[model samples]
Each structure stands twice: as C-alpha cells, then as structure tokens.
Target: MKIAVIGAGSWGTALSTVLADNNHDVVLWTRREEQAREINEERSNYKYLPGFTVPESIRATDSFAECVENTHVILLVVPTKAIRETVQRLLPFIGEDTTLIHASKGIEPGTSKRISEMIEEELGDKKVQSIVVLSGPSHAEEVCKRKPTTVTVSSETEEAAERVQELFMNEQFRVYTNHDLIGVEIGGALKNIIALGIGMNDGLGYGDNAKAALMTRGLAEIARLGVKLGANPLTFKGLSGLGDLIVTCTSQHSRNWRAGFKLGTGYELEDVLEEMGMVVEGVRTTKAVHELAKRLQVDMPITEALYDVLFNGKKPPEAAKQLMGRVRKNEEELASLFLGTGDSDRS
Candidate 1:
C-alpha cells in the first residue's frame, strides 16, 4: 500500500519508518522544504528525533499533491490546532477511496471536538472510506528505536480498524483494534492532562504515594467524561485508556509531563512551552477538558485544578493544596459514577 503521512514531526517520522519497515511505500510530508531536503539528503530529523537515522525507503516531500497522489492511506499526524487548516489544504489531494487516519490526540478548545470530529467537519461533503484513530501508550522516542510498543486503532467499522491494524503491525510495533472509537480518543486526549498533573506533582517533590493517587483518581475523572460522551466504560481499562495514562504520566519522554514538571518547579507556562520547542498538548487539552467538564457537569477535579494552574493565576502549590483538601468519598462510589450504577446524587 502507498501511504502518505501528513506531518514530519517525530511521531510522523517514526510511523513512516514503521510503514516502510512493513514494506509499504511511504511518503512523509513536511511543510518545510529544508526539512524534506534534510530527510532526503542527510537522512536525519535532528530537530525532532535527534541521533535517529530515518529509513532510506521513506521519501520526504513538501508537496501535498506529490505526497497524497496515488496513496491508499493518508495519516494525519499534525497538531490539533493545525488540524482544520491541514485538512483543508490536503482535501484537494485526497482520493475518494482513501482511508483517513489520525494519530493526533487533542480536543479543540471551544468546540471540544476530537481530532476525528475536526477532520470530518473539515472534510464536509467529501466522502472518505473511513476515519480511524490511532492511539495508545506508544511514544515517538521509543518507536524510533524499534523498541517494543503497543497501540490501539479504532474506527466506526470493524473492517476499517482491522485494515489499519494489518497495515502497521510488526514484531516491534503491535497494533490492536477496538470498536470503541469514543473511548479510545477520549482516553488518548485526556491522559495528557493527568500526565501534566503528575509532572507537576513530581516537580513539587511529592513522592510515589501522591503520584499513585493522582493517576488512579485521574483515570476516574477520564472515565467519567468518556462515559458521559457515549464511550463504553470497559474501554477506559483498555490500551487507549489506563494503559496510555500510565505511560504518559510516568515517562520523561512525555512532553505534557515535562511541561507540567516545569510548571510545578515555578516556571511560567509560556516559558515552559518556549523551552520545550514542541507542542505540549496537555496545555491546550487542559483548557478543552476544563470547558467540557463544566458544560457536561462532569466532576473532573484534577482537570479543573490543572486548568486553574495553567490558565488562572493559581500557583502550583495552591492547586495542590486545593486538590488535597477536597472532600473525599469512597473510591467505589466514584467508580460507580462512570459504571452507570451509582445514584444520581453521587454524580
């Protein structure tokens, strides 16, 4: 299969390697002509994936028409904020039979739409075979090294999900198919918020006890929002849910966690983003989830606390203090809220 990966970031490059390794013809698209030349001539994307050699078989280009022409699949890996414009630019090049897949994890702030939703809205009457989401615990750094990694792909149809699974599956990269697109997307997007909070906790010198608490409770908050949005509760326990949460919250490679760590250590949000030099998705996701939770009446305290620290003038320590002082309830009672078995008053 000929695949056009519409982004040249670390994740896009790593995935292009995977597709090339699978013996599929891969074209990687970047907005910068210089970056394309570097990938073609120097075989390195040092700005994003330092010290990693890009596969010789993966061709890079700046032309969307050249990238998407004759391609069977178009994988969207750009940032959430760039999704709309990217789709609009690439729509003219997409084929009627093309399979659309997105690996970006984020919710648009005011719209609260997932990456797939944004793509569909941008697509407008242009019909595609499928809109699939590729998400899980896989990180670009580890993937670039061909380390063991697992991720989930979901779509509205089983055949579409299985087709994506076959396209990317390999010895080092395992792909699983899930029918619950809503849960997978929600889990993938919201996990970054928890990772930011966990990063802040670590930055503040809090120990493992606090980290464990935040992770556990943070998952509950995720499940709450996901279920309210029509996701299956069991999906939250799967790869795209708790699995993604655990990896992002604990890993140093996570930009969200790193950004939160900087914030916890007393750096301003703007400074943290400028220093990272990459999109720390959790900052934007925090604002989106904060608004979604409020509109839906879902109680996501961790999201709210992180939002206050990130957007409001609240300091990290003050947010921590507020989180620790909240009136606590039984864990199972909270679990029941998402399980759809709890009393209405509990919600």
Candidate 2:
C-alpha cells in the first residue's frame, strides 16, 4: 500500500521507517524543503532522530499534494495545534477511498474536541472513509530504532481499526485493536497531564513515595474524567493509560516530562520550552484539560494544579502543596467526586 505520513517529526519519521521496512511505498511530508532534501539525499533527520538513518525506500516530499496523491493511507502525525490547518491543506487531495489515521495526542483548546472530532469537522465524513487513532506508550526515538513496541489502534468502525492494525503490526512492532474510540483517545491524550505533574514532583526533590502517590491519584482523576466523557473506565489500565503515564513520567525521552523537569528546577515555562526546542504537549494539554474539567464539572486536581503552574504563575511548590492539602475522602467518595454517585451517572 502507498502510505503518506504527514509531519516529518520524530514520531512521523519513525513510523515512516517502519512502513518502508515493511516494503510499502511510504512518502513522508515535511514543512521544510531542507529537511526533505536531507531525508532524500542524506537519509537522516538529525534534528529529530539523531544518528539514525532513514530507509532508502521511504521518499520525502515538501509538497502536501505530492504526499497524499495516490496514497492508500494518510497518517496524520502533526502536533495537535497544527491538525486543523494541516487537515485543511490536505482536504483538496484527500479522497473518499483514503483511510485517515491520526497518531497525534491532545485535545483542542477552547473547543476541547478530540483529534478525530477536529478531522471530521474539517474533512467531513464523506471526504474520508475511515478514521483511526494509533496511540500508546511508544516514544518516537525508541520506535525509530526498531525497539520492541506495542500500541493500540481504535475507531468506531471495527473494520477500520483492524485494517490499521494489519498495516503496522510486525514482530518488533505490535498493534492491538479497540473499538472504544473515546477511551483510547482520552487515555492517550490526558496521560501527558499526569506525566507533567510527575516531572514537577521529581524536579521539586520529592521522593518516590510522593511521586507514586501522585501517579496513583492521577490515574483516578484520569479514569474519572474519561468515564464522565463516555469512555470505558477499564481503558485507563491499558497501554494508552497507565502504561503511557508510567513511560512518559519516568522516561527522559518524554518531551513533556523534560519540560516539566526544567520548570520544576527553577526555570520559567517559556525558558524551559525555548531550551527544549520541541513542543511540550503537556503544557497545551494541561490548558485544555483544565478548561474541560471545569466545564464538565469533573474533579482533576492534578490537571488543575499543573494548569496554574504553567499558565497562572503558580510555583510548582505551591501547586504541590495545593494538591496535598485537598479535602480528604475514602476511595468511594473520591470516585463519586469524579463520577457522580447516582444511577444516572453509571453510564
């Protein structure tokens, strides 16, 4: 199959390598003509995936039309902030036969819509045949090296999810299928918020006991809001949920965790972001989640605190103190605080 991977970032490049390795015709789209020339002439994207050479079979293009033209599948891997504009740019070339798969993680600001929602709003149901989201704990750097990785592909259409699962599944790369689109997306996106919180805790010189407590409580909050938003509660225990949270919070490869670490270690958010030279998705995600929690009346203290630290000039120490000083309650009460203890709430 001919595959077009939009956004030649670390994640996009890594997946393009995998597809090329699988012997499929792969085209990677990059905004910079220099990067495209480098990928084609030098077989490397040193800025994002240093020391790793791209496969010769994977072609790189700077033109959006050339990337999507005659492709069987379109993999959207751009940042959340760019999804709308990217989709609009691709709309002219996208056909009804092409399958749309998004691997980007994060809710839209203000609207708080999921990536799928954004795609449908722009392309409409007729422009694209299927929409699938590929998500999990896998990081782009490791994935590029062909490390053993597992991730989930989800869509409302089971056939679409399975089709995507077949496209990427291999010995070194494993894929699972889930019909719960809401659960998979929520788990994949919101875990960044908890990861930022964990990074902040570590940066503040906190011990494992405190970090562990924050992770546990963070899962509860994530599960609560996910369930409230019509996701299956058990999805939080899967790769996109707890697995993603653990890896993102602990791994140095995580941009979000690294950004939070810098912030916790006495640097301002802007300075930390400038130093990273990459998008710290958790910063934007925290803002969207904070607003969503308030609008939906969901209790996400960690998300709220992280938002204050990132946007409202609240210090990490003060945010930690605020989290620690919240009202005490039993596990059931805590669950009720998020899920609402009523028959109507048991959806």
Candidate 3:
C-alpha cells in the first residue's frame, strides 16, 4: 500500500512509522522544506519527536503532488483549524479511488463541524471513495515505542471501516471498527475538555476523589451531547468515549491536561501556549462546545466553566467553585439525558 500522511506533527510522524513498519510505502508531507530535508537526510524530527528515529523507508516531501502521487490512502493528521486549507491544497492531488482517513480531533468553533465534515465540504464535487476517522485513547509517544495501543476506526460504510481496520492493525497496534461515526468523533473531541478540567483540579492540589468525580461526570456530559447529535448511547462506553476520557485526563502525555495544569498554577493562557509551543486542542474545543451547547440547548456545565476560564478572564479557582456549587440533581436523571429520554433540566 502507498500512503500519504498529510502532517508531520508528533501524531502524524508516529502513524507514518506504523505504516512503514507494516511495509507500506509511506510519504510524509510537511510545509517546511527544511523539515523534509532533515527527515529524508538525518532521519530525525527533532522539533516534534525528539530522540525518535524516522524510518528510512518512509520518504518526506513538501510538495503535495509528490506526496499524494499514486497513493492508496491520504491520512490527515493536521490540527482541526487547518483542515479546510489543507484539504483545499491537497484536493487536486487526491486520486479518485483514494481512501480519506483523518486522525485529527476537534469541533470547529463557529461552524461546529467535525474534521470529517470539514473535509467532505471542502472536497465538494471531488469523487472520493471513503471518509473515515481514526480515534481513541492512543497517544503518539506510546505508539512510536510500539507499545500496545488500541483505537477505533469508524465510517458510515461498513466495508470502508473494515478496510481501514485491516490497514492499520498490527501486533503492537489493535484496531476496531464501529458503525457510530458521530459518537466516535464526538467522544474523541470532547474528552479534551474534561482532561483540561481534571488537569486544573490536579494543579489545585485536589485528590483522586475529585478526579474520579470529574471524569465520571465528564463522560456523562460527552454522552449527553453525542446522543442529541444522533449518536448511539452505548458508544460512549467504548474506547472512543470512556477509554479516551480516562487516558487524556490521567496521562502526562496529554497536551490538554498539561495546558490546564499550567492555567491552574497561575500561568496566563497566552504565556502557557507560547511556552508549550504546540496546539493544546482543548482550549479551542472548549469555545466550540460552549457555543454548540448553547445553540442545541444542551446543558454542558463543565464546558461552560472552562470556556469562561479560557476566554472570559475568569479565574480557575472561581471556575472550580462555580462548578462545585451548581444545583444538585439525581444521578439517574442525568443518565436519562444520556439516553435522550429526559428533560434538559440540569437540576
């Protein structure tokens, strides 16, 4: 198989290594010519994956035409904000029969579109075979080390999903197929918000009891919004939902959690972002989910609180206080909302 990976970030490079290990011819695309030269000559991506070796078999390129020429699959791993521009630039290079798979996670802020939706809208009249999403708890750092990592591939077409499952599966990496595309994407995207909240809690010197409460309630919030958007209620219990939430909130590898930890410790948002030097997706996602929840009349208290902290100059301590002081409600009643069988009242 010939595969073109559309980003050279940590996740993109990690996935390219996987494809090369599977003996597939892989071409990695980056905007910087210097990065491409380094990957092809020095065989290292020092800026993103320091100390990690780029497979000699996986070539690197800055030209879209060179990257996608005769490729069987185009795996998009760019940030959600760049999806539209990246698709537009790569549209002419995409083969008619090529499969389109995206590993990016995040909802668009104003448009509230998923990454797959943004790609399809940009493709317009271009005839592509399939649009699939790869998402779950797997982090790029662990994946690069060939650690045991399991993720879900989802698409409306069962055949497409199964084909992707076969393409990425290996002894070190496990792949599962799910028919619930919406649930998988939503679960994968929204979990970052909860991870931010939990990171803030930890930064504030809170214990495991608080972290457990936030994670459990965060799963409920994700399911509630997902069900309202036509996703399967049971999908939230799968790898993309609870599994992803747990990993993102608890692991130090999570950029969102790290970003939140900084915020909780009294670092300004701009300074933190500049210091991290990477995209902390949860900040952008909090804004999008906050707007979407309001438009859909879904109650997402945690998202709202995080939005205030990220955008409205609200202090993290105050946000935590507000979340803790919200009107109490029955846990079963909240679960009912996840099934789409109850009123929207948060109380």
List candidate 2 stretches off by more than 4 Å: 333-347
Instruction: Report every candidate's CA lDDT.
Output: 0.92, 0.87, 0.91
Per-residue lDDT of model 1, residues 197-225, tens digit only: 99999999998999999999888888888
Better of 2 and 3 by lDDT: 3
Over 4 Å off in model 3, which ranges? Answer: 337-347
In angstroms, how far off is 35's CA in candidate 1? 0.8
Give the range of the ten consecutive residues with the poorest summed lDDT in model 1. 338-347
Candidate 2 on 127-151: residue-level lDDT in tens?
7778899999999888888899999
By descending TM-score, how would the candidates be arranged? Answer: 1, 3, 2
Candidate 2: worst-modelled 10 consecutive residues by lDDT: 338-347
| Model 3 Cα lDDT, one tens digit per residue, 1-347 | 89999999999999999889899999999999999999999999998889899989999999988998787799999999999999998777775788999999999999998888899999999978899999999899899999999999999899999998988999999999999999999999999999999999888887799899889888888988888788887889999999999899999999999999998899889999999999999989999999999999988888998999999999999998998898867898556765667763453
Cα lDDT for residue 193, model 1?
Answer: 97
RMSD of each: 1.3, 2.3, 1.3
Residue 157, candidate 1: C-alpha displacement in angstroms: 0.2
lDDT of 2: 0.87
TM-score for each candidate, following the candidate numbering: 0.97, 0.95, 0.97
